[model samples]
Target: MTYIRTVLGDIEPADLGPTYAHEHLVIDGGRPVELYPDFDLSDVDRAVAELAPARDLGLACVVDAMPCSAGRNVRKLVEISRRSGVHVIAPSGLHLAKYYAADLWSERGSVDELAERFRADIEDGIDEHDYLGPVVERTEYLAGVMKIAGSEPSLTPRERRVYEAAASAHRTTGSPILTHCSEGLGALEQVRLLADHGVDPRHVTLSHTDKVIDRGYHREILATGAFVEYDQGFRWKAGVDNGTLTLLAWLFEDGYGDQLMLGMDAARQGYWTTYGGEPGMTFLLGEFAAAMRERGIGDDAQAALFVRNPARAYAFAPVAVTAG
Candidate 1:
């Protein structure tokens, strides 16, 4: 059976029905939040409450993109999953360089060292301390996916190190790689870099690329066989030509639906209803899906974006990892 790992445990791919491929459920205080206050999502009770309606809307699983010290709380994720009965896949790799401090362990550590930590988080368990303080108590909850981010136009040196470490961990643990493409730029470079590191593009998802409205850019990136996740559907105003909808229709028309996925990427507090925000977590399933249907996107195509694509993109490859 092909099983996908989650914060709670592994489950069959079929159980990953109707997933938001990239999101942030809990973001405790950290450098990311310190830099941007709206990024804080620490209240477990609030998160659980906000997720209930979405769960009722058939949001079966969520891939939490917050990773490590950038406010990734494994314990909180576990509790949220258990209480909400919604599967959550936590990330184990790294975020943008700005999320970490200068002279941090991630900045100075070697690729192998970072890879070991990431593998331990995936194959073993996530650090209970969230890699914030020195004290680390490994918990039973595990990370299900690996994450890495790159800046626009080009990847900085530090980001390349993160990519290498994430690729190594993915190779070792058979974990899926989800990446941040700043403003949808540099996705081609991100795909090429991962390819250079011997990572299969099919197992790597490039997120936030929908922000770039250029169809040519998307066509080039999709040619690499990498999965593209669009999360800007809620940004475009109603009665306007939403670029997200326009692009999605173009991609689906081009017959690239299988390599596409959808998410909210609602990392800000202003986006959650529990935090008193509009376009709550259920907006996608409620309003956006209805709009897509009105725009001629059939149920089968919606199924591919919300369900089948995630199952295939996030599934652990069958290749076995060898021990030393």
Candidate 2:
């Protein structure tokens, strides 16, 4: 049977009910913290409390965007999953280069080295210390997805190496590759690079593209058969038309529901209601669902967006390559 890996363990695809394709549930300490203190999600109790309402609203799973060496705490993720009862799929890939120092593994390591580390995270276990220390102690929890990022307007040489490494990991492990499309640009190039690396377009998800509300741009990206994840539903300002909702309406009209996924991407604590944030974690199914239904997006479309699309987009590929 097809299965999706989670921090808790490997589970059947049927168990991934109502999944959020991209998010940041834990960010204890990292470059993000230094740049923005609000990115600190080191509190397990706070995260568990924040997800409570979303869980009650049928938030069965969340694909945590924080990967290894970028504030990805496997222990805390497992704890949150246990406490909140939300299936958590932790990433085994790299984040943007800014999240790490210049001499770190992602910058200095060879593609083979990077690929092997990712494979270990997928097949063996994620490093307990996020691979920052000399002695790497791995836990039982395994990573479920691969993540990579591209700079706005272009991909740097180092970013290319990271992309190749992520593709290699995906090739060996069959894990779906999630991406950070910087400011929603470079998606087409990211998809092209992954395709050239022999990574199936169907096994990719370009995130933050909701920041670009142009329906034509979305159509270009989705036409590649790669999923475009929308997580800016709550960030759009008032007075102007809700671009996120408007884009969703366009996607529904254009029959692109199957190629879409949804999430909060609430990397900062200020985005959580438990942390005095406004919309909180329940914004998608709570507020967005209501808005969608009113716009002719029925239950079928919602299911396709939140459930079926994630099941297919995040599911392991047809066959797993034996070596990294």
Candidates in order have lDDT scores of 0.90, 0.90
Worst 10 residues of 1 by lDDT: 315-324
Clash pairs for candidate 2: none
Regions of candidate 1 where Cα sits further than 4 Å from its true position: 321-324
lDDT of 2 by residue, 1-324 (tens): 668998888888877899989988999898889988999989999899989999999999999998879899999999999999999999988888999998988889998999999999998999988999998988988998998889999999888988898888888888899999999899999999999998999999999998998989999898899998999888877778777888889987887889999999999889988789878999999999998898888899999999999989888986653685
Query: Model 1, 193-258: lDDT tens per residue?
Result: 988998899999999998999999898899899999999999987688889888889999888989
Clashing pairs in 1: none
Model 1 RMSD vs true structure: 1.2
268 in model 1: Cα distance from truth in Å?
1.0
